[model samples]
Target: MVQVMRALRVSRFGGPEVIKMRQIECPVPQVGEVLVRVRAAALNPADWKLSAGLFQSPMITLPFTPGFDVAGVVEEIGPNVTGFQRGQAVIGWTRRGSFAEYTVVPAGVLAVAPANASFGEAATIPTGASTAWQGLFDNGNLQAGQRVLVQGAAGGVGQFAVRLAKWKDAYVIGTASTSNVELVRALGADEVIDYTATRIEDAVHDVDLVFDTVGDATLASSVQAVKRGGTLVTIAGMPSEEKVQEHGINVKSFGVVVTSDLLQNFSQMVDDGALRLLVGATFHLEDASRAYELCQGGHGRGRIVFTVSK
Candidate 1:
């Protein structure tokens, strides 16, 4: 008899209410693929945005499972797969289907989970951490001794940017609500600005790099904080190229790209105790709708996870 597993599926895009947990046939891995028995999955803003029909990309089709990050155990390996074995703990990014109890992901994207991190903690790394890393290093080209400012520093990507920039020897400044000021500091930010109180432009100036997680006005304000030749990297919205050219500064926006190398580096940081995972809350797979609602609620200090097992 074939076994089946439960997955959260959205037949139509709309609100959090569209997500429904249902039983589906478990998939078997194909060549160069591994079937993961998902232990945990992390909720991200992209999950809700995609669910709400905000971000439409050719890579994501309708009537799909809506998770990008997963941490679990490999249950099966497909033909020609190497460097991975059944029953090994792993983490990776999935195009879709991670919201299910089992997902078939490319073996190349899989990496051994950090020994010191829980499955829930490891689940939070792929999308947000990779975005923070790529945005800071790849797009912003932030260097040591430079002053950096991170908007939404209490958020998943923002918090990781703070720590990663600090690890690279940058002087980090961050913006968050007054409630999370200390949390931002603990993440290695040298200065924490309360966006509710002081204006971001007024509090920070001569920044070599600005990592903007909040789009719209916040991204616009970031341009003024960086020096004339500095860079502004946005993960939120694309800025006007004309506006950037006028400022004599570099401006770029990025979408997170996942690969085996990126996942491995993230795992190494966690293993070496250079990075910390912040799991704000967990929901059972059955409560994935609630998880989406919570993520959309918009004040979470860290990643919200969905547990598929245990």
Candidate 2:
């Protein structure tokens, strides 16, 4: 018999109102795929952006399930897969969508869950942390003892950027609103600027890297914060190319790439106590509408996750 499962499907591009929960057939794993029984699914701003017509992609089909990060157990493995076994706790960046009881994950992106973290905690790491990792080390080439300025320091990716820079022995400066000033500081930031009180460019100078998670005007001003030959890496938006040229600095933009190797490295960090994982809020899978609403409105700290099962 074909198994039926509940999923939060985005039937149309709109607000949270467009997300509809319905019973859908469980997807079967194909070659190089694994069927996971989802224990938790983490929500990203991208999810809401896609639903609300703020982001457009040719790959997004209508009536799609609305998540990427998931923590679960392998229910079955498909042909050509190896290393993963049934009933093993795992986490994945399921491009197939995770807002369902089960999601089919590309085997290359699945990793065993971190022993030290819960499902909710594990689910948050793939997207936000990887973006931070790629932006800082891969793009910015950040070095220890150098200074980093992170705009939107209290946000999900910003929180990880602060800690990762600190872990790399870099001095970290972060900009957040008043509510998140202490929060960012607590995450090993050497300094926290309240964005409401001071301009980032006015407060800091010659930073080794400016990692911008907030775009628009702040991204423009961050060019002045970097030292000559330093780097600016943004996951938010691009700076004006001509303006960047005059500053003698390098600017790069990237989207996070999730893979089993990356996930495993993070898992090791969790077990070694060098990294901390967090979730701002959790909802039942059936309450996905509320989850979408909260994520769309913006979260103050950590990732919002859906607890799909025990």
Candidate 3:
């Protein structure tokens, strides 16, 4: 008999209403890939945006699943795949889509899930945490003793940015709404500015790195906070090229590159308590419509996760 699975499908592109639950075939792992029995899947801005038809990608088609991150147990391995066994817990960026009871992930991107984190917490890493990790270390080249600013410090990626920067011994400043100011500080930000009342550029200056998880207006103003020679790395919108050239500073907006090394580092940090994760809300697979709605609503405090199993 053929096997089937439950998945959140986007049959049409428009709004959160486009997403619905559907019964689908359980994907089989191909060579260099593994089929994961998903425990949880986390939402990213791109996920909902794709549902709303915001991001352009030739690969996106109707009746597709909408997720990038997954934490699950390995159910099967494919040809030429090694180092992973059936039933091993793992977390990864599937890219193909993960909002399902089963999803196939490339073996190269998979990492052993952090033992200390629940599936929900581990789910936050693939996209959100990795984005923060790469922005600071890969793009910004932030070093110990340097001063760094985290834009939207109470956000999913921002919390990871603050914790990771501090673990590297950098002096970390964070911008947040008043409601989350204390949360950002507790995450180890050396300074937390309530962005609602104070503009980030005015409160601090001459930082070595500005790690922007918030873009647009906040990112535009954040440029001045960087020392003339410092770097501005944004995961959100990009600043104009002309404006960057005039500032005499380095600027980069990078897509997170997920490798076993990067994933392991994030897992190790979580295990060591140098980093932590939070799931602002969790919905079962059947409730994905509501999950998509909340994620699209914006200004959420934690990662939105769908607990697919257990």
Q: Which segments of model 1 are wrong by more than 4 Å?
A: 57-59, 240-242
The TM-score of predicted model 1 comes to: 0.96
TM-score per candidate, in order? Answer: 0.96, 0.97, 0.96
How do all the candidates rank in terms of lDDT, highest first? 2, 1, 3
Error of 2 at 47 (Å): 0.4
lDDT tens digits, residues 1-310, model 3? 2299888888888887778888988887889999998999998888888888888778877878889899999998999998999889999888778999889999999999999999999999988788888899989999999999999887778888898899999999999888888888888899999988997767989889999888989877778888888899998898877777777789998777778778888899889987888887888878777877887776777688889887
Which of the two candidates, 2 or 3, achieves a greater TM-score against the reference? 2
lDDT, candidate 2, equals 0.89
Give a tens-digit lDDT track for model 2, residues 152-239. 8888788889989999999999998898888888888999999889987789999989999988888878998998898999888888
Give the C-alpha miss distance for residue 221 in model 1, angstroms: 1.3
Q: Write out the backbone clash pairs for model 3.
A: none
Model 1 C-alpha RMSD to native:
1.5
